[model samples]
Target chain A: MSPNVKHRERNRRAARWLLGLSLVAALFFGVRVGLDMVYWNDPKHHEQQLEPWMTIGYVARSWMLDPRKLRDALALEPVPDRKTSLGHLARQQNIDFETYALRVMDVIARQKAATE
Target chain B: MTEVALEWLPVYGLPVLVLIIGLGCLGAPAPASLTLLICGSLIAAGDFSGAQVYVTSLVAAIFFDHAGYAVGRWGGARLAHWRIPLMDRARHMLKTRGGMAVFLTRWLLAPLGPGVNYMAGVVAMPLRRFTPFDIAGEVVWVTLYLGLGYVFGSYVSQISEVLGDITGFLAFAVLAWLLWRFIRSDLKR
Candidate 1:
């Protein structure tokens, strides 16, 4: 084959490989997004893992529960800094992390039940 | 500053992020990757959803990539009059290598982002050829930065600061080297 023909052939092969890779990526992202959406929509998924390090602010926003209501129900001090994780606050207030997790979990469970 | 922005994210939400990223892709000086990283940290911290942050940043980046492409498309030959690094080389790559050039620059030498977008337009790369590679490249960029933030959420503030300092120093070093090269070339001539 001529040099020009060889170059064109190489380009065509590259394009084909790119197209195949792109299709695989699209399929992967689609399935991942679908699974995430289903997981997020299911209330049970929220309770699956309640880590001590999670913040009150994070929990409120994720569950669509009111921060003020959740705090009050849990009888917690005002957390002005949203980044303050539950584990840190529990230590500061001399409260057990497990107790903190359980209280927040209870509130989350109640909120989910009310919505359903 | 990243902390301040992170704190505001939940209050301001996705619109702010989308706007900033769009502007950054259009050649505006903004901390686009840093913003994605912060969003990722927030998602990992449970302050925001991972899917939402990913989707928002992707759309904004791709939209602005198109805008930059449009500007290049409209400017055409006139863009060649402007001085930019690797302009001639980029034009050649776009012509010879095609969309793979677009894909590589999207994540690799991301600082040259706007330059590549504009060059693609100036060279009249077809929209069909540009869009797919652009989207795929953006996915890699978004996911990589976000994943870093998610895994290192607790240490993100320090990580961003260190990265920022390094980026600034590198940019200065590159510019100084380029200036020196230009002067040497002129002297040689």
Candidate 2:
């Protein structure tokens, strides 16, 4: 109700958000010891392995979302393990080279749709 | 210029490397001027050639400064999420001190360029307001270092001795700050 309460509340949210972010960054960038501590197995190293459902999450995390869209997208049920992780899918079919190729094509199609 | 030490360490050696690694060493425990001064000492002590060390250190300094700048831009508003209290302190410092924060970060504290860049971005400071000061800081900062090194080239040892003392103190200060934060945060939790 008071300004002090509001300021404290805001700072508390900021601190909590920052703490979560640090843990995520630490996990991605590796441990405090050194860069060497970031194992090859770390998920960040496998960024290209992202799946379709995960894009919403990544885009959301990147703060590129249009507010409610991200939350709503993520809130929906995940579409099962369509193809393991993007890792196995890429290995099996080179999705980056293939699917990404098609996604570019899809953009063109969408562009055509927009013009019409 | 020291040839004897360069033989063992190859690009002048480990102290320089560690210095760079310390916060990527781009600027370091002090200002860019102090870095050049310390490198000059290695030259005077016959540790490495002053010119060669200067060139390498300069390249590293420029590269990292710009790199920090670019990365700072990439994170922009997200800098607040960094959780580095120094950055938060810097943000508050900039808010109060205004342009003076840029000068101090570039010189006094030496965390100005990248650290302040991100803080500025987070606060959404105008790029115009940011660039000229940054360029001025870099140009002036660079000139001061190289000038100091060249002027006192012969007395590099004295320069290094003084810088080494200051760096040691700053290093301890940094470690103490980190330890303090760790303890304080733990207490907060």
Candidate 3:
């Protein structure tokens, strides 16, 4: 085959492969996102059980609360930096994180009520 | 620096993200994946929607992947033909396992992704094989970082820092490996 003809043939094959791969990738992304949405919307997934190792940043994300506001509401000293997990903060304050997490939940409840 | 660009993410938006990632893939010293993670953080913050960021990032990455490949084809191949130790080893890697090398560099060792793209081109890996695997690898790379950003938006800065360190360490490790291999081969001869 002429060099030009060979090049054209190669390009066509590559294009076909690209289309196939794109389709597979699109399906994978769609399924993953769809599943995450479904799990999030399910009320069963709303289990509010906070673990000791969770950070205020994490709680804010899970609970859809504002991290900054949560910190201010809890009057958390020295500000809750990203690396500071809840368990460490609870220890600093001489309380178990369960009690501390409950207090945060209560604050979130009051804030919601005030907004409502 | 990648972190500095990140601070401007809220102000500058998607175009900036796309540009930085493209250039970074072409051997620019920007932390591309970390930027994606920050973009994910923005998605979580509701500044840009997930689909929009995902599409933009994927296209940008794939576009640059091809560009780097082309660079390797035209530019890097010349060096591969020379008696260079590093180039020879890279050519060997591309010859032995081009697709898996492409995939691994694309996501797992992302800092090396661009270099691999260029090297794959230098070794004349078929575009039919290279492009599809490049896309698949990018899917994982983009999704993982963006997912992290979405889930851990509040801790994005810290995550960026950690990932940057990991990329740096990996890059260093790769360089060290190349140097060691070169010395060992020299001693054998």
Candidate 4:
């Protein structure tokens, strides 16, 4: 065989490494879909549970869990009843509109959690 | 995009095309790591099949990365004459940070990987100097994301949870470290 043919053969051999990577990709996509189906159907695994925004809100709420405890952090008075309507609580506090909005959402989440 | 479009062959094929096109145009402006993470999860769930797809992707990424490094390696003969618009910042980044910047962008965040190559090409960065860094970066990138896919098995939501845990740990560490530093600095001052 000519040098070019030999060179081409060498390249082919080296490229075989990609075959393994291809298998992995196949497995990845295959398994991923299966897991999603299971997760979507199962109520306990949180597969299809909350919307994206709700998850973010949940995490944000955890960050400010102790709003009233920390002297350095923003210290807002806790709503007297976790079940109180957010609109009513916001109106009573006279807080900034943005602040009230977020508080109202959190308050609603708290109320919703209580009922659940 | 539709789920069908995201099949194994296309994922692998597109990047290879990019590599064949000589990588300068293909290398830059790569997608974010989150996308790969998303893929990782999908793979685990058994949503996609085709080993050829990932292998193609890996090879394409490495190939393009290398091509970019090569273009950069060759002194500015091509770049100075090339008529690319609004790529000064990237070109500047390539110059100042050198191979470290290239490596990091390729390995860490990833979006910048191809862009770094283009910039290096624009300025005529030498191929010899660009090779090692590009190689290392590709290895790192492949290992991290591909490994994540292998281990986690691909379910976007599950991977999201893992991501959440990582984010939480980093957040807590940052907060604690800052608090400690603030106290110590205040006492000294």
How close to the true structure is residue B48 of candidate 3, measured as C-alpha lDDT?
A: 66
Q: How would you class the docking of model 3?
A: incorrect
lDDT (C-alpha) at residue A31 in model 2: 32
Best by DockQ: 1
Lowest lDDT 10-mer window, candidate 1 chain B?
Answer: B166-175
Per-residue lDDT of model 4, residues B31-97, tens digit only: 3233354344434433333364356556666676666555555644555663322234335545666
Candidate 1, residue B25: the lDDT equals: 90
Better of 2 and 3 by TM-score: 3
**Clash statistics: count for each candidate:** 0, 4, 0, 37
> What i-RMS does each candidate reach, in Å?
15.4, 21.9, 16.0, 22.7
* Reference-based lDDT, residue A56, model 2: 29
Candidate 2 C-alpha lDDT tens digits along B96-124: 66465555455444533555555665665
What are the runs in model 3 whose C-alpha is more than 4 Å off? A1-116, B1-4, B84-86
Please rank every candidate by TM-score, starting with the best.
3, 1, 4, 2
* Residue-wise C-alpha lDDT for candidate 2, range A1-116, written one tens digit per residue: 99766755666565555555544443432332234334333766532222221222222323233323433332333444221222233344555534753553354344446546
Q: lDDT for each of the candidates?
A: 0.68, 0.45, 0.70, 0.46
Ordered from best to worst lDDT, the candidate numbers read 3, 1, 4, 2
Question: In model 4 chain A, where is the ten-residue run with the lowest total lDDT?
Answer: A50-59
Q: TM-score of each candidate? A: 0.54, 0.38, 0.59, 0.39
For model 2, the stretches where C-alpha displacement exceeds 4 angstroms are A1-116, B1-35, B38-63, B79-96, B111-114, B154-158, B164-189
Off by over 4 Å in 4: A1-45, A48-116, B7-55, B67-96, B157-189
Q: Which candidate is the best by TM-score?
A: 3
- Model 4: per-residue Cα lDDT at residue B57: 51
Q: How would you encode candidate 4's per-residue C-alpha lDDT over A1-116 as one tens digit per residue?
A: 99766754554443344334434444554555566567657867743222121222122332333333321122334443322222333445775435755654555457446546
